[model samples]
Every structure is written in C-alpha cells, then in structure tokens.
Target chain A: MPSLKNIAADLPPVQKTRRVFDGSFMVLLVLTLAGGVAVGVVSGWARVGQILIETFEFIAMLAPKIGAGIFIAATLPILLPRERVGRLIGRESGVRGLVVAAACGAALPGGPMMTFPLAAGLGVAGADLGAMVAFISGWSLLGLNRTLIWEFSFLPSDLVWTRYLLSLPMPVLLGLAARAVMQRRLA
Target chain B: MNILIGTVLIGSGAIWLWWQLPNDAWRSASYRASLDTFLFTAPRVIVALLGAGFFAELLPEDEVRQLLGAEAGIAGILLAIALGPLTPGGAFVSFAIGAAALKAGASPVAAIAYVTSWSLFSTTKIFAYELSFMGRQATLTRILVSLPVPFVIAAMASLTG
Candidate 1:
C-alpha cells in the first residue's frame, strides 16, 4: 500500500467557486424587494408616499453607519498592531498565552462579523490561534451594545447588571477551554 | 412641514429631558446607558440590513426552520449553531424567526440557540472579509471557538424557563 502522505497527496483537488451570485445573495434581493412591496401595499399609496420620504431619511441615517463600518474595518488591522496582538493574545504552542488571548479579545469591538475578518488578517500577519479564539469568544460573550441599550430602557436596573455581571466570566472560561483544546490537538 | 415640526418638537422634548435630569441619578445612568447602547448597535443594524439584502435571496425561512425544527433535537441545535455564521439579519429579524420557530413547536432552547448564534456569527461575512484580513488560521479559530457559545447560552436560558 502507498504511504499515508502519498495517499493524502493523491486526493482530488477541491474546486473553488466564484464569489458572486451565490444562493444567499439572490435570496436577500428577493426578500428586500418583497418586503418593500409588502410595506407599500399594506400602507396604501398615501403611506407609500410617506414611506418613500422616510426611506430617504433612513438612507441618510445609514450613511454614517456605513462610513463608520468602513473606517473600523480599515483601521482595526493597524490599531491593534499584529506583533503586540500576537504576543499579548497569540494562541502559541503554550498554555499561558490562552488566558491573555481571551482578555484582549473581549476588549475589542464590532462582534464576530467584524472581528473574524480582522482576526484572520492578523493571523496572516503572524498572530496566533489563541488570540483569534479569545477575540471571537470575547466579541460574542461581551455586549457593549446590550449593556448600553438595557441601561437606557425601562428594564430593571438589577436585571441588566446581573446579566452583564454573569456574562463577564464567560470570555475567560471560553478562552481557557479553547486553549486546552488547542493544546490537546497539538500534542 | 408637519413632519419637520414634529421632529423639532421631539428634539426639543429630548433636550428638555436632558436638561431636567439630575446629573448622577439612576435615571441618568439608564439614559446614558441606553444612548451608549444605541450608538454601539446602530452601526451593526446598518450592517445587518445590508447583509439582509444580500442574504434574503439565499436561504428561505422554511428551509431554515425545517433544518432546525423541534424534530431535529440536539442535531437541530448543532445545525443552528453551525448555520449561525450564515445568517445576516439583525436581532429584529432573528427574533421574529425565533418566535415563529417557537410557535412551530421548536424547543425553546433550540430557538434561543438559533437566535443567539445568528446574532453572533455569519459565514458569508467570514468568507467575504474576515478571512481576507484575519487570515485562514485566525478566521477558522474564531469560527470554531464561537460554535458552542450559543448552545451554552441557550442551555442556561432553558434552565430558567
């Protein structure tokens, strides 16, 4: 029989698909148009007129957010220097970096959607797996947005505080667990 | 003109409330916290809407529900967590879907898990941008780490329920 490495190498190459016109994109477009039409029909022509006006207002509100996202996306790679991020939060071959990785990850912004790309880029630039895990877990578990929203609403003060307090330990735990898994995988 | 006038009136009332509030009270804390939350989430909401527009064409609700329905059990929960990275809508849309799933007799834990996962992850986003910036290892690591979080959160929620 052929060697394991030779066998692995003999596997067929996977085909890479084009990025555009994926199933999800088509679905999103249909939903938006359908939603627009539904809104227009439900509200009537007069309401449609108002909606048209409101749409412009909504677009105006959206402009800044889009700009901010672009800015954040652009700046994150630079803001958290790759070497420092790696050293501080890198998922190295060792275990100590795991805890550090988790703490640093939780403090970063933009949630998994935004951070995933950033983390991947950082990894390319020499960041470690530990840091990336910390970052992902941190973004998911921590909620700067929810904390702010809950504080503002009519919700009970203690309830919101309790949730935040409870959530605080999760990022650390997740980071540690990930590190343990990684160590085992490596070993 | 009426809309403009109403906007101005609302703005002024908001200002009046700000002016009237004591600087350090619980009410002030609540208002500040809410404002901060709005500021934080507002951008994500925009991203979600754009993502919704992009993803609306891909997965239908029926398919989503079918995949993660009550009949699926832990498999459904795992599928929901895995698929979380694919969803693009904000909490409003996610919550609406979760409510519908609950009504359809999906386990409360599973529905909550789906919502939490959807809120936290998106595969389209990962492939489109994250991988480019964070690199494959980091991107993959993050995705792997996030995979189980929703289940844990959902489990906790279920326990209370």
Candidate 2:
C-alpha cells in the first residue's frame, strides 16, 4: 500500500488562473461612459464645460487628503518589515495570539483596495493566514480618523463610544468562527 | 503693474463666465441633495485622513504583516479575523496586504476572510460617519446586515482557496 506522504506527493499540482474582468464590470463601465456622454451631449458644450469646471473644483478640494493618503500608502511597505510583522502577530496557536491578532486587525488603515495589495505582498514575503486575517479584521473596524471627525462635528459621543465598544470584540469572534469553518472543511 | 492688471481682469472674467452658465433645472433637487450629503460627509473625510496619518506613524506595517504570517493555525486565523478592522489602508490597500500575507504563507481562507471583514465591517467609519449621517437605527441595521457578509464570503472563498 502507498504511504500517505507518497500518495500526497503523487497528487497533481493545482492549476491556478488569473482573474479576468468579468462581464458585470465591463457592462458597468460601458454604461457609465455612455451615461457621461449622453449627459454631455444633452447638456450642450457650455454645460459640459461647466461640469468639467465643477469636477476640477471638487478634485481641488480633495487633493490634499488624497495626495497624503497616496504618499502614506507608497511608504507603508518600506516602513514595515515582513519578518517582524510575522513574528509579532502570525503565531496564532493559542489564546494569546488570538487576542494580539484582534488588536492588530483593529489598527490598520484604508479599505480593501489598499490593504489587500499590502497583505498580498506580505504573503509573498512569507506571512501566514492567521496574521493576514488579523490585519484585515483590524483594518475594517477600527478608525481613528472616523472617531476624531465625528467627535469634532458635534455628533453623539455616546453613539461613537458604544460603536467602538461593541466593535472591539467582533474581530475575535469572526476570526474564531472563520477558523471553525475552515477546520471543518479541512476535515 | 500691467501684468498684475491683466491677471486680475482674466480671473474676474473667468469667475463671471462660470457664474453665468445655465444650470440644469430638472436635476437641481437631486444635485442639491447630493451636495448636502457631501457637505455633511466632508468632516468625516478630514478625520479619516488624520487617522490614517496617525496609523501610519504609530503601528509599523512590517510588524502587522509579520503577525499575520507566522505560525497561523486555528488561533492565528481567529486573531487575523479579529484584527481586520485595525489594519491600515482601504479595501484596495488591504487587498495588497492580503496578497503579501498569502505570499508569506497565510492561508487563502484566512486572507479572503480578512479582506471581506476589512471592507464591510469597519468600526471606525461606523462610529464617525455611518451612525451620525444616517442615525442610530440606520447605522445599527447596516452593521447588523454587514456583519455576516464577510464570514459567508470568506467561508466560500476558503473552499476554493
């Protein structure tokens, strides 16, 4: 009888395929462009000119923050080393790791567009699944940016605090749940 | 003196022309509503930027990546999920981080889980903008609705990954 190792070794390598732009995305893009053209034509050249000016004004208003975000994103990879990140948050073998993982997850910035690429790069550099999950989890729920803005704007302090308090434990719960699901599948 | 005068004349003429443009009467209501939304949301954007800067300064990315990459067993998976919100950058940025974690040996399931949670269940944005703009009921409903999406998506992705 063949050994388990031998049987495993004999299995065919999984073929991976690159994700392509799906029909929905293409359709959406086409529709958007068509709409823009229709609006411009219907509105006339003067209106189109006004629209462009308005668009520029909007861009100008957002330029500073957007520019800073871009700069920070560019520098993130260099600032954080892969090995150190792995060592600190990747060892998810027990309860301690789980707690640390949750904390780490709540700390990262931006949304998936920025975090996903960075996480992938880290994976390429040799990060683990647990750490990746923690990082992703942390990025979603914890927002120092949102907190300060709401606080300054005269929104309810209680609401902000309650949300923060409630969110603190969610990542850990989600992580554990995900683990159970994954394990069940593996089994 | 001549150049300064020319510049002033041009600037004022440009402003006058812009102000004189015919406005869309039909779309005005919707446009105004969108403008109101923008005005209401502007402060949140400012706060988000400041928070992003603070995150960049405080928690080093290298440290974060390492934690997610090493010895990720069941516990690690749970930890990663929990940390989804705190991770820096946005959805696109987090995706990159997810990719990096995967390259470093993170499981595909955990990575997908992290991405889903990161995008859909942000605590910081909820407290600051979602709750305030839409009110507690709307915010709570969104959070409740969004909470499960990542797990469902991640579980499915895990099977394929």
In terms of DockQ, the best-performing candidate is: 1
lDDT of 1: 0.49
Predicted structure 2: lDDT: 0.44
Instruction: Identify the runs in model 1 with alpha carbons over 4 angstroms from their true place.
Output: A1-30, A41-99, A111-114, A117-127, A143-168, B1-83, B89-111, B134-145
lDDT per residue (tens digit) for residues A1-110 in model 2: 11112222232222222223434234434543454455556655565455445545634644443333332222222233334454566544554565665565454433
i-RMSD values for every candidate model: 16.8, 22.6
- Per-residue alpha-carbon lDDT of model 1 for B98-158, expressed as tens digits? 4445554456557556655764565555666666766665556556766666777756654
Give the interface RMSD of candidate 2.
Answer: 22.6
Which candidate gets the maximum TM-score versus the true structure?
A: 1
Q: Candidate 1 lDDT, tens digit per residue, A1-187?
A: 1111232223222222233344544565566656556645655556544645554565464344333332332233323334456554533534455555545555443444445555555455554556556666555555433223212121233333443454566666655666666787889
Which residues of candidate 2, in runs, are more than 4 Å off?
Answer: A1-32, A41-47, A92-96, A102-106, A109-114, A117-131, A141-168, B1-118, B121-161
